[model samples]
Target: MMNRLKAALAASAVMLAPVFAAPALAETELIFNSYLPPHDELYQIAIRDFAAAIEKESAGGIKVTIPDTSLAPSDRQYEMVRDGIADMAIVSTGGVPQLVTLNKIGDLPFNSPSARAASIALWETYNTYFLPFDEFKGVKVLSTNVLPGRQILSVGKLQAKTVADLKGAKLWSPPGALSEAVKKLGAVPVNSEFTDLQEYVTKGTVDAMVMAPNSAKGARVLEYVTGMTQIPGGLGSLSFAVFISQERWDALSPEEQQAIQRAADGLPARTGAAADEVLAKLAPEMAKVPTENLEGAQLDEFTTLLQARIDEWKERAAKKGLSDPDEVLTFYRDVLAREAKASGS
Candidate 1:
């Protein structure tokens, strides 16, 4: 069934192929490495849907080979591209903080309302302020994308009613800004991947966890996480940097580059769509379990607390020689507002 689905997807891609202004004779092959498993929809769509578009747009001259692996995780994907271990890979900067501080702006709590707004702002930031090429010496970024925001998940009884309620709780979180946020909430932050969530929750090693609405479904952790709070409006919005080895990027013909860029145009939109789809698809089942939607003053307090963290991030950025921090932040805010207004957010 999966193969048939992939085949059908590939056919659709070829049908929507774009015609280039000028045709070239040279052909190129690029390896597209991902940390996601094959069964995951995001990985499949990227490999099958996006790759098909590339092949079609290049008129069959440019081929992208996607290898499925969890061994080379997202944190290592940047290094893989930098050192040429892999030609190209998708990475989340939030996974490694010290090395990529600038990228964390996308992960600031409550700065963005949804993945679409965040993704658009992220592209603008990367292009205008934090140019990926300038920051990472040996690789070129082909695309940037945003994931959905994280939610606070707990077992048996809910404890995240007030900021004070989070005190003394053992909470599991991925490494990066969110971990820091957990610390602020007075929860002990345990560094664990989403895959470990169910085990940790079931065994009482972790009383709560921060996860994307979709990730619980992908990792099958929803079975253990019965309560969820919308405490992280922007914490889930991670900017994914897709890098191609400079050597590989340089080797490609101009035609291939054009084809690749054309293929990458709507990556942010697609990623955001995937996130929304996950929420919409999962909401029904999630409703079967007990869930309370936080809004009004409660939601406002969460956003305010999260915004304080954003201020700290800006100060950190300034210390790192990103002069005009306010300008960069203002630009981000403005972009968010513009996109939100356009989308009726």
Candidate 2:
């Protein structure tokens, strides 16, 4: 009888031991939604690296998952995050102008010397001044980045030799500062989503487009592209942001928040570096494509037009109640200079 009782007790202990040894579930699972395809360079740099960093920093307490397909369209990203459809998303500031007005300071033509400088400057400025704006009220901004300026990608034999050449040209334009600048440059701005650029160019709906190299390559626009005008300082660099839902952010403990921030701290620079590397690799592929480098008198003319647009931007910002737009611009330029000098760009 004693042996049977001991056997029954041993069996009960074994069953309970299995349950007790099980690992604890993660406290949070963040779902990151991205519009870029899985294999795109930006996806690898911004989405993959960010997710990995967060997972590692959380030490199994938080997990991040990116869906195989984008949860929402590019323009709807901000709304998706704010509405809790996605925990986090990568969104372009130009794509959502109404919600990201102040952040467009980086989008001014010839604003920063390089992607690295622009990205760092944008991130720092956002933390300093743009945080108080109502535009960012419903989301927790993680980091900001900029592309390596916009170059003119023209289909067929068209070439923009000078500012006068741009007159009457039909150009596909992204919204915000770039669109405004394109109009001022005497090009007829044909507004469209970046994703639809190839169709528009192929159909001859537009004669040229101002876009980042990596983005143009990814969109496969190069297949129809016959010539490229590499403008110095470019038309402008598009600014991007990684953000999380305010509701989701509030749910995290202070330690968790810090852990996430630690992962995000250097993301802009990392992304900019990654983009530069990818562009370098893609350069050879574009070797046979006819290209012109804007310089000398033509380049100076473009730069002058850009300055006038900058003044206009300042006026708009001031009208929106941002005090000392000049100071803000000066601060951004200073940051860019410092970053450029430090990076030897």
Candidate 3:
């Protein structure tokens, strides 16, 4: 999972020789690293489309080029950008916990019903509360989006309607808080990137997974099991931030910087919408997989077990220098609810 290309470190600004076409194309060229697969719509809208928009907004004064392959692995993206191996890319907050603890507070279970709203809410919360702390000190954050909540999928059945059903079960969990949540609830956790989930499930290394419903299709794990229990928001979620090396952002002319910011506006919603679209497309098939609706006492019980997640999160947030972390969490939820209602999503 750590496999990364050794690309030459780039300078703060990679202004390339302008094309000799009838109209001069660019004075500034930014290398936007592509990490996820071609089918990933977030990359399409946030990276590729944003690049084109910035070029137009700047009247071709800025150009962004994507390499055929990524300069670094997904987990290595932020480090690469901060060290100047790439100009811009989306960094995963959950994947790099130490560098981005505060952002994960907004990812508590049952966060938002709509990806677009959750994403917009997450960014608003970040800009207001976390920015002054410089959580991501070396890179210039453009925008952020949290992925849709993951379903609690068991291998071949939906027996997870009760906490007892999960006891001693080997469940694949995203590392950090989610893993802690799984353990606190009595399930044995197998920690790894969801990209490798298929191998584990197929090899019988784990009996269940906490992941986005679309991963059943994307990771080719749809045929393996039939049980599904979606946790509101997500069982846990990953947050992504589009960022450019601070040096690169600082090097841009005032006009060029504004052009890029204009193009970056609403990126969180745009990426979140793309993610929702993919989830909606696969939802029907997911519905066919036997699911147990969580309600009544069962829901209450589950929530009780999840108190540890909240308690643990608050401690982490306070330790990170955030005052009144609980208020911050409430602020995120209020914003999410309002945005979701306004958008009718």
The reply for model 1, stretches above 4 Å from the true place, is: 1-26, 68-71, 232-236, 295-297, 300-304
Local accuracy of candidate 2 as per-residue lDDT tens digits, 217-244:
7877877887888876678878899989
The clash count of every prediction, one per candidate, is: 3, 0, 2
TM-score of 2: 0.90
TM-scores for every predicted model: 0.85, 0.90, 0.90
How many pairs of residues in model 2 come into backbone collision? 0
lDDT minimum window of 10 residues, candidate 3: 4-13
lDDT of 3 by residue, 1-345 (tens): 223322322221233323333576589999999798878887788888888999989998998999889999888988888888889988778757768888886567777567787899899999999999898988889989988876678875438888898999888887776677788768998987667888998898887887777766788887787688766666667678888999999999999999999999889999889889998898778778888778788777888888778887889889989999889988998998898778776
Model 3 pairs in collision: 149-233, 149-234
Q: Against the correct fold, how does model 3 do in TM-score?
A: 0.90
Estimate the lDDT of model 2: 0.83
Candidate 1 to truth, TM: 0.85
